[model samples]
Target: MEKSIHKDQVERFGSILLEIGSLLMSYGANSMRIRVTLNRIAKAFGYNLELLITHRALMLHIDDKDDQHSFNQLKRTSPHGVNFRLVSGISNMSWRIVSEKWSLDEIEKEIERLKSLPHYPRIIILLLVSLADLSFCRLFGGGMIEMSIAFGATFVGLFVRQEAVKKTFNPYICIFFASLASSLISGLAVKFNLGDHPEYAFATSVLYLIPGVPLVNSFSDIIDGNIMNGIVRGMHGMVIVLSIALGLALSLLIYQI
Candidate 1:
Protein backbone atom coordinates (compact mmCIF):
# COMPACT_ATOMS: atom_id res chain seq x y z
CA MET A 1 0.00 0.00 0.00
CA GLU A 2 2.85 2.39 0.77
CA LYS A 3 4.47 1.63 -2.56
CA SER A 4 1.16 2.22 -4.33
CA ILE A 5 0.89 5.61 -2.67
CA HIS A 6 4.43 6.47 -3.71
CA LYS A 7 3.79 5.52 -7.32
CA ASP A 8 0.63 7.62 -7.42
CA GLN A 9 2.45 10.63 -6.06
CA VAL A 10 5.20 10.31 -8.62
CA GLU A 11 2.69 9.94 -11.41
CA ARG A 12 0.91 13.12 -10.33
CA PHE A 13 4.20 14.98 -10.29
CA GLY A 14 4.96 13.68 -13.76
CA SER A 15 1.64 14.95 -15.08
CA ILE A 16 2.19 18.41 -13.63
CA LEU A 17 5.75 18.59 -14.85
CA LEU A 18 4.66 17.65 -18.36
CA GLU A 19 2.05 20.39 -18.25
CA ILE A 20 4.61 22.95 -17.13
CA GLY A 21 7.23 21.91 -19.66
CA SER A 22 4.82 21.80 -22.57
CA LEU A 23 3.43 25.21 -21.68
CA LEU A 24 6.89 26.74 -21.59
CA MET A 25 7.84 25.10 -24.86
CA SER A 26 4.73 26.32 -26.64
CA TYR A 27 5.22 29.89 -25.42
CA GLY A 28 8.83 30.33 -26.69
CA ALA A 29 10.90 29.51 -23.59
CA ASN A 30 14.32 28.18 -24.48
CA SER A 31 15.24 24.60 -23.58
CA MET A 32 17.66 25.67 -20.86
CA ARG A 33 15.08 27.83 -19.14
CA ILE A 34 12.48 25.10 -19.28
CA ARG A 35 14.90 22.50 -17.94
CA VAL A 36 16.02 24.78 -15.13
CA THR A 37 12.46 25.62 -14.15
CA LEU A 38 11.49 21.95 -14.06
CA ASN A 39 14.55 21.08 -12.01
CA ARG A 40 13.72 23.77 -9.48
CA ILE A 41 10.18 22.54 -9.05
CA ALA A 42 11.28 18.89 -8.72
CA LYS A 43 13.93 19.73 -6.14
CA ALA A 44 11.29 21.44 -4.04
CA PHE A 45 9.19 18.27 -4.20
CA GLY A 46 12.07 16.05 -3.11
CA TYR A 47 12.52 14.61 -6.58
CA ASN A 48 14.92 14.99 -9.49
CA LEU A 49 13.89 15.66 -13.06
CA GLU A 50 15.57 15.08 -16.42
CA LEU A 51 14.03 16.77 -19.39
CA LEU A 52 14.60 16.30 -23.11
CA ILE A 53 13.32 19.21 -25.12
CA THR A 54 12.74 19.23 -28.85
CA HIS A 55 10.99 21.60 -31.17
CA ARG A 56 7.73 19.67 -31.15
CA ALA A 57 7.75 17.60 -27.97
CA LEU A 58 9.14 17.16 -24.46
CA MET A 59 10.35 13.97 -22.75
CA LEU A 60 10.55 13.87 -18.96
CA HIS A 61 12.01 11.43 -16.47
CA ILE A 62 11.43 12.10 -12.79
CA ASP A 63 12.38 10.00 -9.80
CA ASP A 64 12.19 10.66 -6.10
CA LYS A 65 15.39 10.80 -4.06
CA ASP A 66 14.57 7.52 -2.39
CA ASP A 67 14.67 5.74 -5.77
CA GLN A 68 11.45 3.97 -4.88
CA HIS A 69 9.25 6.20 -7.01
CA SER A 70 9.86 7.01 -10.66
CA PHE A 71 7.87 8.36 -13.57
CA ASN A 72 8.58 8.78 -17.24
CA GLN A 73 6.51 10.69 -19.69
CA LEU A 74 6.52 12.11 -23.21
CA LYS A 75 4.17 14.90 -24.14
CA ARG A 76 3.90 16.66 -27.48
CA THR A 77 3.88 20.43 -27.22
CA SER A 78 1.43 22.68 -28.98
CA PRO A 79 2.48 24.89 -31.90
CA HIS A 80 5.02 27.48 -30.82
CA GLY A 81 4.05 31.15 -30.39
CA VAL A 82 5.52 34.18 -28.64
CA ASN A 83 3.93 34.79 -25.26
CA PHE A 84 6.51 36.28 -22.94
CA ARG A 85 3.82 36.90 -20.35
CA LEU A 86 3.08 33.20 -19.95
CA VAL A 87 6.75 32.32 -20.10
CA SER A 88 7.62 34.75 -17.31
CA GLY A 89 4.57 33.74 -15.35
CA ILE A 90 5.65 30.10 -15.41
CA SER A 91 9.18 31.03 -14.40
CA ASN A 92 7.92 33.07 -11.46
CA MET A 93 5.57 30.26 -10.46
CA SER A 94 8.49 27.86 -10.32
CA TRP A 95 10.30 30.15 -7.89
CA ARG A 96 7.19 30.45 -5.77
CA ILE A 97 6.82 26.68 -5.73
CA VAL A 98 10.35 26.42 -4.46
CA SER A 99 10.34 29.22 -1.87
CA GLU A 100 6.82 28.78 -0.59
CA LYS A 101 6.88 24.99 -0.85
CA TRP A 102 3.63 25.05 -2.73
CA SER A 103 1.52 21.94 -3.01
CA LEU A 104 0.86 20.35 -6.39
CA ASP A 105 -2.70 21.66 -6.40
CA GLU A 106 -1.54 25.22 -5.79
CA ILE A 107 0.92 25.02 -8.64
CA GLU A 108 -1.71 23.60 -10.93
CA LYS A 109 -4.14 26.38 -10.05
CA GLU A 110 -1.52 29.01 -10.77
CA ILE A 111 -0.79 27.51 -14.17
CA GLU A 112 -4.46 27.59 -15.02
CA ARG A 113 -4.73 31.20 -13.95
CA LEU A 114 -1.73 32.20 -16.03
CA LYS A 115 -3.18 30.46 -19.03
CA SER A 116 -6.41 32.39 -18.58
CA LEU A 117 -4.70 35.77 -18.58
CA PRO A 118 -6.04 37.87 -21.45
CA HIS A 119 -4.00 39.59 -24.12
CA TYR A 120 -4.45 43.21 -25.18
CA PRO A 121 -7.41 43.86 -27.45
CA ARG A 122 -6.87 43.20 -31.17
CA ILE A 123 -7.51 46.79 -32.27
CA ILE A 124 -4.90 48.09 -29.84
CA ILE A 125 -2.35 45.59 -31.12
CA LEU A 126 -3.07 46.48 -34.76
CA LEU A 127 -2.68 50.20 -34.12
CA LEU A 128 0.54 49.80 -32.12
CA VAL A 129 2.11 47.51 -34.70
CA SER A 130 1.17 49.85 -37.53
CA LEU A 131 2.61 52.81 -35.63
CA ALA A 132 5.83 50.92 -35.00
CA ASP A 133 6.19 50.13 -38.71
CA LEU A 134 5.54 53.77 -39.56
CA SER A 135 8.30 54.78 -37.15
CA PHE A 136 10.62 52.33 -38.87
CA CYS A 137 9.82 53.99 -42.18
CA ARG A 138 10.89 57.38 -40.84
CA LEU A 139 13.98 55.91 -39.19
CA PHE A 140 15.02 54.52 -42.56
CA GLY A 141 15.07 58.05 -44.10
CA GLY A 142 11.54 57.99 -45.46
CA GLY A 143 9.50 61.21 -45.62
CA MET A 144 5.95 61.74 -44.34
CA ILE A 145 4.43 60.20 -47.46
CA GLU A 146 6.34 56.96 -47.03
CA MET A 147 5.48 56.80 -43.34
CA SER A 148 1.78 57.24 -44.11
CA ILE A 149 1.88 54.48 -46.68
CA ALA A 150 3.64 52.15 -44.27
CA PHE A 151 1.12 52.86 -41.55
CA GLY A 152 -1.87 52.08 -43.72
CA ALA A 153 -0.28 48.98 -45.18
CA THR A 154 0.72 47.64 -41.78
CA PHE A 155 -2.75 48.18 -40.33
CA VAL A 156 -4.47 46.31 -43.14
CA GLY A 157 -1.92 43.51 -43.19
CA LEU A 158 -2.07 42.93 -39.46
CA PHE A 159 -5.83 42.92 -39.53
CA VAL A 160 -5.71 40.18 -42.14
CA ARG A 161 -3.29 38.18 -39.97
CA GLN A 162 -5.52 38.50 -36.92
CA GLU A 163 -8.55 37.36 -38.85
CA ALA A 164 -6.62 34.45 -40.38
CA VAL A 165 -5.44 33.35 -36.94
CA LYS A 166 -9.00 33.48 -35.64
CA LYS A 167 -10.06 31.10 -38.40
CA THR A 168 -7.20 28.68 -37.49
CA PHE A 169 -5.31 28.90 -40.79
CA ASN A 170 -1.78 27.52 -40.95
CA PRO A 171 0.55 30.08 -39.36
CA TYR A 172 2.92 30.31 -42.32
CA ILE A 173 -0.01 30.72 -44.64
CA CYS A 174 -1.28 33.56 -42.50
CA ILE A 175 2.09 35.25 -42.65
CA PHE A 176 2.27 34.90 -46.41
CA PHE A 177 -1.14 36.46 -46.86
CA ALA A 178 -0.29 39.31 -44.46
CA SER A 179 2.92 40.04 -46.30
CA LEU A 180 1.24 39.93 -49.67
CA ALA A 181 -1.49 42.27 -48.51
CA SER A 182 0.99 44.77 -47.08
CA SER A 183 3.28 44.67 -50.10
CA LEU A 184 0.41 45.13 -52.49
CA ILE A 185 -0.68 48.28 -50.64
CA SER A 186 2.81 49.73 -50.23
CA GLY A 187 3.75 48.86 -53.81
CA LEU A 188 1.25 51.45 -54.90
CA ALA A 189 3.58 54.18 -53.67
CA VAL A 190 6.27 52.85 -55.98
CA LYS A 191 3.90 52.40 -58.90
CA PHE A 192 2.52 55.94 -58.66
CA ASN A 193 5.78 57.64 -57.58
CA LEU A 194 3.99 59.22 -54.63
CA GLY A 195 7.05 59.51 -52.38
CA ASP A 196 10.71 60.36 -52.72
CA HIS A 197 11.52 57.03 -51.04
CA PRO A 198 8.71 54.77 -52.20
CA GLU A 199 11.08 51.82 -51.99
CA TYR A 200 11.56 52.54 -48.28
CA ALA A 201 7.81 52.52 -47.77
CA PHE A 202 7.50 49.25 -49.68
CA ALA A 203 10.35 47.66 -47.82
CA THR A 204 9.33 48.68 -44.29
CA SER A 205 5.67 47.86 -44.61
CA VAL A 206 6.24 44.14 -44.08
CA LEU A 207 8.93 44.49 -41.44
CA TYR A 208 6.41 43.64 -38.79
CA LEU A 209 6.25 40.08 -40.15
CA ILE A 210 9.86 39.34 -39.26
CA PRO A 211 10.08 36.32 -36.94
CA GLY A 212 12.13 38.13 -34.33
CA VAL A 213 11.24 35.99 -31.34
CA PRO A 214 12.01 32.68 -32.96
CA LEU A 215 15.26 33.96 -34.42
CA VAL A 216 16.43 35.31 -31.05
CA ASN A 217 15.40 32.16 -29.22
CA SER A 218 17.17 30.07 -31.84
CA PHE A 219 20.46 31.80 -31.16
CA SER A 220 19.97 31.52 -27.42
CA ASP A 221 19.28 27.80 -27.71
CA ILE A 222 22.37 27.28 -29.87
CA ILE A 223 24.60 29.23 -27.50
CA ASP A 224 23.25 27.15 -24.62
CA GLY A 225 24.20 23.91 -26.49
CA ASN A 226 20.69 22.84 -27.49
CA ILE A 227 21.81 22.29 -31.06
CA MET A 228 18.84 20.33 -32.36
CA ASN A 229 16.24 22.66 -30.94
CA GLY A 230 18.24 25.63 -32.10
CA ILE A 231 18.52 24.31 -35.63
CA VAL A 232 14.81 23.57 -35.79
CA ARG A 233 13.98 27.06 -34.57
CA GLY A 234 16.42 28.64 -36.99
CA MET A 235 14.90 26.72 -39.85
CA HIS A 236 11.45 27.77 -38.70
CA GLY A 237 12.48 31.42 -38.74
CA MET A 238 14.00 31.05 -42.18
CA VAL A 239 10.82 29.49 -43.49
CA ILE A 240 8.89 32.51 -42.27
CA VAL A 241 11.33 34.80 -44.06
CA LEU A 242 10.95 32.73 -47.19
CA SER A 243 7.21 33.13 -46.96
CA ILE A 244 7.66 36.89 -46.74
CA ALA A 245 9.96 36.88 -49.75
CA LEU A 246 7.51 34.88 -51.82
CA GLY A 247 4.78 37.35 -50.98
CA LEU A 248 6.99 40.27 -51.94
CA ALA A 249 8.02 38.57 -55.18
CA LEU A 250 4.41 38.07 -56.19
CA SER A 251 3.76 41.74 -55.52
CA LEU A 252 6.71 42.72 -57.70
CA LEU A 253 5.42 40.51 -60.47
CA ILE A 254 1.95 42.04 -60.23
CA TYR A 255 3.25 45.61 -60.38
CA GLN A 256 5.86 44.60 -62.99
CA ILE A 257 8.53 46.13 -60.80
Candidate 2:
Protein backbone atom coordinates (compact mmCIF):
# COMPACT_ATOMS: atom_id res chain seq x y z
CA MET A 1 0.00 0.00 0.00
CA GLU A 2 1.20 3.46 -0.83
CA LYS A 3 1.64 6.06 1.91
CA SER A 4 0.90 9.78 1.85
CA ILE A 5 3.92 12.07 2.22
CA HIS A 6 2.08 15.06 3.59
CA LYS A 7 -0.92 15.81 5.79
CA ASP A 8 -2.14 18.24 3.16
CA GLN A 9 -2.22 15.47 0.61
CA VAL A 10 -4.18 13.23 2.96
CA GLU A 11 -6.75 15.96 3.52
CA ARG A 12 -7.07 16.53 -0.20
CA PHE A 13 -7.60 12.82 -0.80
CA GLY A 14 -10.28 12.65 1.85
CA SER A 15 -12.07 15.63 0.33
CA ILE A 16 -11.95 14.02 -3.09
CA LEU A 17 -13.27 10.77 -1.64
CA LEU A 18 -16.14 12.73 -0.11
CA GLU A 19 -16.80 14.41 -3.43
CA ILE A 20 -17.13 11.01 -5.10
CA GLY A 21 -19.49 9.84 -2.39
CA SER A 22 -21.67 12.93 -2.71
CA LEU A 23 -21.86 12.57 -6.46
CA LEU A 24 -22.84 8.94 -6.15
CA MET A 25 -25.50 9.77 -3.61
CA SER A 26 -26.94 12.61 -5.67
CA TYR A 27 -27.10 10.29 -8.64
CA GLY A 28 -29.24 7.85 -6.63
CA ALA A 29 -26.70 5.19 -5.84
CA ASN A 30 -27.83 2.84 -3.10
CA SER A 31 -25.86 2.51 0.14
CA MET A 32 -24.25 -0.81 -0.78
CA ARG A 33 -22.81 0.44 -4.03
CA ILE A 34 -21.57 3.63 -2.45
CA ARG A 35 -19.88 1.80 0.37
CA VAL A 36 -18.26 -0.69 -1.95
CA THR A 37 -17.03 1.98 -4.31
CA LEU A 38 -15.58 4.11 -1.57
CA ASN A 39 -13.86 1.12 -0.04
CA ARG A 40 -12.32 0.19 -3.35
CA ILE A 41 -11.11 3.73 -3.91
CA ALA A 42 -9.58 3.87 -0.45
CA LYS A 43 -7.85 0.58 -0.95
CA ALA A 44 -6.51 1.84 -4.25
CA PHE A 45 -5.18 4.99 -2.65
CA GLY A 46 -3.56 3.07 0.22
CA TYR A 47 -5.68 4.45 3.06
CA ASN A 48 -7.53 2.76 5.85
CA LEU A 49 -11.06 4.05 5.41
CA GLU A 50 -14.45 3.67 6.99
CA LEU A 51 -17.84 4.91 5.80
CA LEU A 52 -21.14 5.57 7.53
CA ILE A 53 -23.82 5.97 4.91
CA THR A 54 -27.48 6.89 5.00
CA HIS A 55 -30.11 8.36 2.76
CA ARG A 56 -29.48 11.94 3.86
CA ALA A 57 -25.74 11.93 4.42
CA LEU A 58 -22.39 10.22 4.04
CA MET A 59 -19.62 10.18 6.65
CA LEU A 60 -16.13 9.07 5.77
CA HIS A 61 -12.89 8.68 7.72
CA ILE A 62 -9.53 8.21 6.06
CA ASP A 63 -6.32 7.36 7.90
CA ASP A 64 -3.02 7.87 6.16
CA LYS A 65 -0.20 5.67 7.35
CA ASP A 66 2.90 7.73 6.59
CA ASP A 67 1.82 10.75 8.60
CA GLN A 68 -0.51 8.89 10.92
CA HIS A 69 -3.10 11.55 10.23
CA SER A 70 -6.79 11.01 9.77
CA PHE A 71 -9.27 13.18 7.90
CA ASN A 72 -13.01 13.13 8.13
CA GLN A 73 -15.53 14.26 5.56
CA LEU A 74 -19.29 14.50 5.64
CA LYS A 75 -21.65 15.52 2.90
CA ARG A 76 -25.41 15.92 2.88
CA THR A 77 -27.21 14.90 -0.26
CA SER A 78 -30.74 14.87 -1.60
CA PRO A 79 -32.10 11.93 -3.52
CA HIS A 80 -32.13 12.27 -7.27
CA GLY A 81 -33.42 10.21 -10.15
CA VAL A 82 -31.63 6.96 -10.97
CA ASN A 83 -29.36 6.92 -13.97
CA PHE A 84 -27.89 3.52 -14.70
CA ARG A 85 -25.37 5.14 -17.00
CA LEU A 86 -23.99 7.16 -14.14
CA VAL A 87 -23.92 4.17 -11.85
CA SER A 88 -22.13 2.08 -14.42
CA GLY A 89 -19.61 4.82 -15.07
CA ILE A 90 -18.87 5.19 -11.39
CA SER A 91 -18.51 1.44 -10.91
CA ASN A 92 -16.10 1.25 -13.79
CA MET A 93 -14.15 4.23 -12.51
CA SER A 94 -13.71 2.69 -9.10
CA TRP A 95 -12.05 -0.41 -10.53
CA ARG A 96 -10.02 1.58 -13.01
CA ILE A 97 -8.57 3.62 -10.19
CA VAL A 98 -7.42 0.42 -8.55
CA SER A 99 -5.91 -1.05 -11.69
CA GLU A 100 -4.39 2.04 -13.28
CA LYS A 101 -3.47 3.94 -10.13
CA TRP A 102 -4.27 7.28 -11.72
CA SER A 103 -3.43 10.56 -10.03
CA LEU A 104 -6.08 12.64 -8.30
CA ASP A 105 -6.17 15.21 -11.09
CA GLU A 106 -6.79 12.61 -13.75
CA ILE A 107 -9.56 10.99 -11.73
CA GLU A 108 -11.13 14.36 -11.05
CA LYS A 109 -11.11 15.25 -14.73
CA GLU A 110 -12.70 11.94 -15.62
CA ILE A 111 -15.34 12.38 -12.94
CA GLU A 112 -16.20 15.80 -14.35
CA ARG A 113 -16.59 14.32 -17.79
CA LEU A 114 -18.80 11.57 -16.45
CA LYS A 115 -20.89 14.10 -14.55
CA SER A 116 -21.59 16.05 -17.70
CA LEU A 117 -22.43 13.01 -19.79
CA PRO A 118 -25.81 13.47 -21.43
CA HIS A 119 -28.68 11.16 -20.58
CA TYR A 120 -30.93 9.68 -23.17
CA PRO A 121 -33.10 12.35 -24.75
CA ARG A 122 -36.47 13.11 -23.17
CA ILE A 123 -38.28 12.38 -26.41
CA ILE A 124 -36.78 8.92 -26.46
CA ILE A 125 -37.80 8.31 -22.89
CA LEU A 126 -41.34 9.50 -23.60
CA LEU A 127 -41.63 7.20 -26.57
CA LEU A 128 -40.39 4.24 -24.60
CA VAL A 129 -42.82 4.96 -21.80
CA SER A 130 -45.68 5.12 -24.22
CA LEU A 131 -44.63 1.82 -25.66
CA ALA A 132 -44.38 0.21 -22.25
CA ASP A 133 -47.81 1.41 -21.19
CA LEU A 134 -49.24 0.22 -24.44
CA SER A 135 -47.70 -3.16 -23.79
CA PHE A 136 -49.15 -3.20 -20.30
CA CYS A 137 -52.59 -2.50 -21.67
CA ARG A 138 -52.28 -5.32 -24.17
CA LEU A 139 -51.00 -7.76 -21.57
CA PHE A 140 -53.97 -6.93 -19.41
CA GLY A 141 -56.25 -7.97 -22.31
CA GLY A 142 -56.98 -4.56 -23.76
CA GLY A 143 -58.22 -4.85 -27.32
CA MET A 144 -57.10 -2.92 -30.39
CA ILE A 145 -59.21 0.22 -29.85
CA GLU A 146 -58.59 0.26 -26.09
CA MET A 147 -54.87 -0.20 -26.66
CA SER A 148 -54.86 2.72 -29.07
CA ILE A 149 -56.57 4.97 -26.57
CA ALA A 150 -54.21 3.80 -23.83
CA PHE A 151 -51.16 4.52 -25.96
CA GLY A 152 -52.23 8.08 -26.70
CA ALA A 153 -53.31 8.80 -23.13
CA THR A 154 -50.14 7.32 -21.64
CA PHE A 155 -48.04 9.30 -24.11
CA VAL A 156 -49.63 12.54 -22.97
CA GLY A 157 -49.47 11.58 -19.30
CA LEU A 158 -45.78 10.74 -19.57
CA PHE A 159 -45.17 13.99 -21.38
CA VAL A 160 -46.75 15.85 -18.50
CA ARG A 161 -44.41 14.00 -16.10
CA GLN A 162 -41.43 14.80 -18.31
CA GLU A 163 -42.34 18.47 -18.29
CA ALA A 164 -42.82 18.48 -14.53
CA VAL A 165 -39.39 16.94 -14.01
CA LYS A 166 -37.80 19.46 -16.36
CA LYS A 167 -39.42 22.26 -14.37
CA THR A 168 -38.12 20.76 -11.11
CA PHE A 169 -41.55 20.62 -9.51
CA ASN A 170 -42.09 18.87 -6.21
CA PRO A 171 -42.11 15.16 -6.98
CA TYR A 172 -45.45 14.54 -5.33
CA ILE A 173 -46.99 17.44 -7.17
CA CYS A 174 -45.52 16.22 -10.41
CA ILE A 175 -46.82 12.70 -9.95
CA PHE A 176 -50.20 14.07 -8.94
CA PHE A 177 -50.39 16.26 -12.00
CA ALA A 178 -49.26 13.55 -14.35
CA SER A 179 -51.64 11.04 -12.87
CA LEU A 180 -54.45 13.56 -12.94
CA ALA A 181 -53.82 14.38 -16.58
CA SER A 182 -53.60 10.75 -17.59
CA SER A 183 -56.63 9.65 -15.63
CA LEU A 184 -58.64 12.58 -16.87
CA ILE A 185 -57.86 11.71 -20.43
CA SER A 186 -58.70 8.06 -19.78
CA GLY A 187 -61.92 9.00 -17.99
CA LEU A 188 -62.91 11.16 -20.90
CA ALA A 189 -62.40 8.24 -23.27
CA VAL A 190 -64.58 6.05 -21.09
CA LYS A 191 -67.23 8.78 -20.94
CA PHE A 192 -67.24 8.90 -24.73
CA ASN A 193 -67.31 5.08 -25.03
CA LEU A 194 -64.15 5.22 -27.12
CA GLY A 195 -63.33 1.55 -26.66
CA ASP A 196 -64.35 -1.63 -24.90
CA HIS A 197 -63.39 -1.35 -21.22
CA PRO A 198 -61.71 2.03 -21.39
CA GLU A 199 -61.35 1.70 -17.65
CA TYR A 200 -58.41 -0.64 -18.08
CA ALA A 201 -56.40 1.99 -19.91
CA PHE A 202 -57.43 4.59 -17.42
CA ALA A 203 -56.40 2.47 -14.47
CA THR A 204 -53.05 1.33 -15.77
CA SER A 205 -52.03 4.61 -17.40
CA VAL A 206 -50.15 5.93 -14.41
CA LEU A 207 -48.27 2.76 -13.60
CA TYR A 208 -45.27 4.29 -15.26
CA LEU A 209 -45.04 6.79 -12.48
CA ILE A 210 -44.55 4.11 -9.85
CA PRO A 211 -41.23 4.53 -8.06
CA GLY A 212 -40.01 1.11 -9.07
CA VAL A 213 -36.36 1.70 -8.39
CA PRO A 214 -36.86 3.19 -4.95
CA LEU A 215 -39.18 0.43 -3.88
CA VAL A 216 -36.79 -2.21 -5.07
CA ASN A 217 -33.82 -0.40 -3.61
CA SER A 218 -35.60 -0.13 -0.33
CA PHE A 219 -35.86 -3.88 -0.16
CA SER A 220 -32.28 -4.23 -1.29
CA ASP A 221 -31.04 -1.84 1.37
CA ILE A 222 -33.03 -3.53 4.09
CA ILE A 223 -31.70 -6.91 3.09
CA ASP A 224 -28.20 -5.45 3.20
CA GLY A 225 -28.80 -3.93 6.67
CA ASN A 226 -29.03 -0.26 5.79
CA ILE A 227 -32.34 0.00 7.55
CA MET A 228 -32.68 3.76 7.73
CA ASN A 229 -31.97 4.34 4.10
CA GLY A 230 -34.25 1.48 3.22
CA ILE A 231 -37.06 3.00 5.20
CA VAL A 232 -36.48 6.43 3.74
CA ARG A 233 -36.52 5.08 0.20
CA GLY A 234 -39.58 3.02 0.94
CA MET A 235 -41.33 6.06 2.30
CA HIS A 236 -40.54 7.97 -0.85
CA GLY A 237 -42.10 5.23 -2.93
CA MET A 238 -45.12 5.10 -0.67
CA VAL A 239 -45.70 8.83 -0.94
CA ILE A 240 -45.49 8.68 -4.70
CA VAL A 241 -48.05 5.90 -4.75
CA LEU A 242 -50.32 7.86 -2.47
CA SER A 243 -49.98 10.94 -4.65
CA ILE A 244 -50.90 8.87 -7.67
CA ALA A 245 -53.91 7.42 -5.92
CA LEU A 246 -55.01 10.89 -4.82
CA GLY A 247 -54.70 12.15 -8.34
CA LEU A 248 -56.77 9.28 -9.66
CA ALA A 249 -59.42 9.84 -7.02
CA LEU A 250 -59.60 13.55 -7.80
CA SER A 251 -59.86 12.87 -11.51
CA LEU A 252 -62.63 10.37 -10.96
CA LEU A 253 -64.50 12.82 -8.78
CA ILE A 254 -64.10 15.72 -11.15
CA TYR A 255 -64.95 13.71 -14.26
CA GLN A 256 -67.54 11.50 -12.63
CA ILE A 257 -66.80 8.74 -15.09
Q: Tens-digit lDDT track for model 1 on 130-150?
A: 999999999999999999999
Q: How far is candidate 1 from the true structure (C-alpha RMSD, Å)?
A: 0.9
Question: Per-model C-alpha lDDT, please?
Answer: 0.93, 0.85
Compose the digit string of candidate 2's lDDT tens values, residues 1-257: 34446677888889888888888877777889889998999989889998988777889899865647899878887767777787789889999999999899988888898889998887888888888888888888888877777777788988898789889999799899999988888888788877788888888788888889889888999999999989998998999999999989998899786
Q: TM-score of every model? A: 0.98, 0.93
Number of the top candidate by lDDT?
A: 1
lDDT of 1: 0.93
- Residue 138 of model 2, lDDT score: 89
The ten-residue window of minimal lDDT in model 1 covers 78-87
lDDT of 2 at 185: 84
Query: By summed lDDT, which 10 consecutive residues of candidate 2 come out lowest?
Result: 1-10
As for candidate 2, its clashing pairs are none
